[model samples]
Target: MNGADVIDIARDAVYTLLIVSGPTMAIGLGVGLLIALFQALTQIQEMTLTFVPKIIAIFLALVLFMPMMGAQMGDLMARLMDRVATGG
Candidate 1:
């Protein structure tokens, strides 16, 4: 493939990756930020306090968004396979 083709493929992969991972990441970030604010306000300096809630929130988000993630991944894979098939 040429530079344009490589760039297009990389762009698509990045797009698909972001689409697949964005929900869980956003959830984790939001939760973590809230927890940080709470900790700051409460002056609770417990190191492990921040992780559990963020992880749980991210897990829940992943579970909720699993179908969409799967579809995005599947579409990206199908596109790649088609490109390979057609020698794109």
Candidate 2:
């Protein structure tokens, strides 16, 4: 593969990565923010408080989005394999 092909493959990989990770990351961010707000309001400075909810929310999000994530990853893999097959 030449420079352009390499760039295209890299771009596609990054795009797919972002698409796969965006939802779970957003959920985690939302949960963390909410927890932060709660801590701020209550003055309950418990370090572990944020970890549990964020982890749970992210885990649930992964479960809920697993199919879509798989589809995206499969598509990316197919594209990469196609490129390899074509000697690119």
Candidate 3:
């Protein structure tokens, strides 16, 4: 592929990655910030307190967003395959 074609593919790949990761990351970030605030307020500075809820939320988010993420990845892969087929 030429430089412009490669740049296009790279841009699409990054966009796909962001789409797939956005939900889970947002969940994790929200949960972690909440937990941190709670810890600061309550003085319950246990490490597990910090990690457990955020992890759970992230996992839940992953479960909920899995189908959408998969579809995005599949679309990117199909586009890549098409580029390969046509010698982009």
Candidate 4:
């Protein structure tokens, strides 16, 4: 592929990655922020406190969003394969 085609594929790959991972990342961020706020208010400096809740939330988010993530990844792969098949 030419430079522009390569760039387009790269952009698509990145976009798909972001779309697939967005929900889990957002859940982790939100849980972490809430934990931080709780720690701040209570003055409990426990490093491991953030880990469990964030992990659980992220895991739940991944499970909940698995189908959408799979669809996004499938679409990306389809586009890529189509490009290859067309000799792009």
Better of 1 and 2 by lDDT: 2
User: What TM-score does each of the candidates earn?
Assistant: 0.94, 0.95, 0.94, 0.97
Give all candidates' CA lDDT scores: 0.92, 0.96, 0.89, 0.94
Candidate with maximal TM-score: 4
lDDT, candidate 1, residue 6? 98
How many clashes in each structure? Answer: 0, 0, 0, 0
Total backbone collisions, model 4: 0
Better of 3 and 4 by lDDT: 4
Compared with the true structure, what per-residue lDDT tens digits does model 2 show for residues 1-88? 6899989999999999999999999999999999999999999999999998998899999999999999999999999999899897
Q: Model 1, 1-88: lDDT tens per residue? A: 9999999999999999898988888888899889999999999989999889988888889889999999999999999999999999
Residue 23 of model 1, lDDT score: 82
How far residue 63's Cα lies from its native spot in candidate 4, in Å, is: 0.2
> Which pairs in model 1 have colliding backbones?
none
Q: What is the lDDT of candidate 2?
A: 0.96
For all the candidates, what are their Cα RMSDs to the real structure? 0.8, 0.8, 0.9, 0.6
Report the Cα lDDT for candidate 1.
0.92
Q: Using lDDT, rank the candidates from best to worst.
A: 2, 4, 1, 3
TM-score between candidate 1 and the true structure: 0.94
lDDT of 4 by residue, 1-88 (tens): 7999999999999999999988899889999999999999999999999999998898899889999999999999999999999998
Q: Which stretches of candidate 4 lie over 4 Å from their true place?
A: none
